[model samples]
Target: MPAAAHDLRTPLTVVLGQAELLERRLARDPSAPVDPAGTSASRARRDGCETS
Candidate 1:
């Protein structure tokens, strides 16, 4: 299972980075539209969608 976990590390890091990036952007531009707001509720719903 370590290999599987290791394989996921890169993608999980990307997820966290993207979340951080979204947070930074949202902080800079509060009024900007970011899909469903990236709130906990919205994030839970958006977790499944593939990003570019």
Candidate 2:
């Protein structure tokens, strides 16, 4: 794979993994409160590191 694609895929993988975990947790307990800063993707977005 190209370096650019790899770079994009890495963060996307992390985001997708976090999303799946959240989905499972929410399924078990829909009343659970979700923290905006709970995932790395959220932190990246807050820190302006996320391009998309």
Candidate 3:
């Protein structure tokens, strides 16, 4: 169980970091349309980093 949690940690860290960044950007430019579900904005930020 610990190993599984550990394995998931890194990816979750990356996701959380991306989410934090997106939250900032969204706070700064909150005009961007976002899905009501919230994950869309986070995925958009992650995708932005992936492209770059």
Best model number under TM-score: 2
RMSD of each: 6.0, 4.7, 8.4
lDDT string for model 1 (1-52, tens) is 9788677766766776677677777779968776655554346337843333
On residues 15-34, what C-alpha lDDT tens digit does candidate 3 reach at each position?
A: 76777777778877767776
Error of 3 at 14 (Å): 0.7
RMSD of 1: 6.0
lDDT of 2 by residue, 2-44 (tens): 8897799688778766865776677589688777556555565
Kindly give the number of clashing pairs for every candidate. 0, 0, 0
TM-score of each: 0.53, 0.55, 0.53
What's the lDDT for all of these models? Answer: 0.62, 0.67, 0.64
Q: Which candidate number would show the highest lDDT if scored against the true structure?
A: 2
TM-score of 1: 0.53
lDDT (0-100) at residue 47 of candidate 3? 60
Model 1: residue 17 alpha-carbon error in angstroms: 0.3
TM-score of candidate 2 against the unseen true structure: 0.55
